[model samples]
Target: MPIFGGSSDSEDERTIHHTPKLFTRQQSIHSLFGGGKFADILLWREPKIASTLVIGVSLLWFLMEVVEYNFITLVCHASMTSMLLFFIWSTASDFLNWERPIIPEVVLDESSFKHLARSFHARFNQILSKLLDIACGRDPPLFFLTTISLYILSIIGTCFNFVNLLFIGFVSLLTLPVMYELYEDDVDTVAGKLMRKMRKLYRKVDSNVLSKIPRGTVKSKKHT
Candidate 1:
């Protein structure tokens, strides 16, 4: 019996039997790992660390500002400031790494990758809607506003004293995660949706072109 429009029962059975189960399992594993598994881990972990660093540095800066002039205080403040600056730089670098492109070729094919990408895109869109609500001053986190305020304060404090340096550094460190959250949340906006659709179309076209080229030709051209 022919199923769908093409293969007979015997042909279908042979195809099914010949297909490697290992390949299917490997594909599933690759998809799970490649589709933002590490990214999610980093995104979740970095923010908490950044937030803690920001709070600690901000408190130290506040203490330095309140106390009178003293060598010990100055030394402590400077050390804290240095550590805070290091954290800020590290966090920024990590953010850059997070933004690095995940090439689609590694994990997806023309037949199934498009569907996976679309699902992620839809989830991202939902995240974006939530982010917009936060940004609009409706049930927004106090910590978010406080973080921004402290960052501005730290910048201004820099003009008057070195203590503010620590504050600025910490706040800057915190900002990276905040920005990421904002971006992650907005993945479903009109522009984001449009971009995803365009990319999907391009991928489909590219896959079609590749599919038409004979496999033997591709191998020969590569060898030559």
Candidate 2:
């Protein structure tokens, strides 16, 4: 299924006349990676980065296995301790003129503050509405499939390591959007043809077996 759900009127077009019919390898790589034609594809591909990151971290796990090193606990303690001390180090001279303060200065006037708050509230509502649509509505062709896929992923999350899930999602995020964008125009015709074939197959199946099946599921219960 295409990663991004929710379709528009423009998506129904058989062909994107502006897009070139022929696709080259470099163009494909560049589209996904955001690189020059000559740039190394491995540098931009998320799977490669995620895999390498895991392999590198596996060395620490290997150390723990062989040498009885407390690398995992040490990492947690060291990171938290370092961050705490580092923040204290920011307690310095001048009018709180620390070079890298975590918080930004609040310089807004009352009107500007109200405007910013209103803007954020409006944006949040828009996002919430879109999320509701994606969760419940099947207006988009991929909506039901995407929803089921995510539900399955959540169910399986407990079986895998956090890093594994992170990498999986990281790769999906990096590749899916660009791949769909680059090939969407070409895919329309293929999707249409495939749908036609599927409909034909379904008609035969329906006539033979599905039509005879009871419609018990379709019946709604009334609240007393």
Candidate 3:
């Protein structure tokens, strides 16, 4: 049997294992998030790309949330601004006898598009399968956590608009992963203690309160 519920070396699976562990099979923070260019960007391995992404998202959040700009309106305004600038440059180049501006053609690769579509399809199926498993009580802990999470999100929905919520999530994405990576062991220790306390509390409730609840007993009817 594999230790900590991890696969063999041939599987190329790496998992974090130490005292006071909350998640037994959980991969490293980097590996948990796909562990490539995306992981690098999220973990700030490439500071330039990560900062650019943060700045872009922040600018979008400011425009959409604070400025109250509609998405379509924003796109149209940006497009018009670009066209105006290009027109001005073209006219100036002609007047000054300089070379006209060249615009690069943007083409979507067929292989890349197919790969993206297949990835989405697989991910969608995986999520649906997981939901089915959870609903079927295959993972009681996961089901309980999912229910609580949805309930919290429902409460949050009433307090913030979709754009505001997305911006908040984006901000969290930029900050949370890096912070957790920096203090992984400390966070795990705290989480492990909390989990143990919660388990004891749950056991008490199950024995004292839930166990006392009367369950309906079914009777079979017989015909004479």
Candidate 3 similarity to native, TM-score? 0.75
Q: Could you arrange the candidates by lDDT from highest to lowest?
A: 3, 2, 1
Q: What are the TM-scores, per candidate, against the unseen true structure?
A: 0.25, 0.37, 0.75
Runs in model 2 deviating more than 4 A are 1-75, 78-159, 214-224
Counted clashes in each candidate structure: 4, 0, 0
Measured on C-alpha atoms, candidate 1 has an lDDT of 0.50
> Top model by lDDT, which number?
3
TM-score of model 2 (CA atoms): 0.37
List model 1 lDDT by residue over 1-224, tens digit each.
00111123453345433432221233332243344533343334455654566566666665667665465867887889977877777677676764433335675468577766887797688657656654664432322443566699877875865656655555664454445446633422433333334434544755797467766534445554
Regions of candidate 1 where Cα sits further than 4 Å from its true position: 1-48, 69-160, 184-224
Q: How much is the lDDT of residue 139 in candidate 1? A: 30
Candidate 1, residue 6: CA error in Å? 48
In the range 18-111, model 3's lDDT, one tens digit per residue, is 3433445357888766666768988999999999988998998889888989999999998999999999999999899878889999998998
For all candidates in order, the CA lDDT equals 0.50, 0.53, 0.72
Q: What are the clashing pairs of model 2?
A: none
Span of 10 residues, lowest total lDDT, candidate 1: 1-10
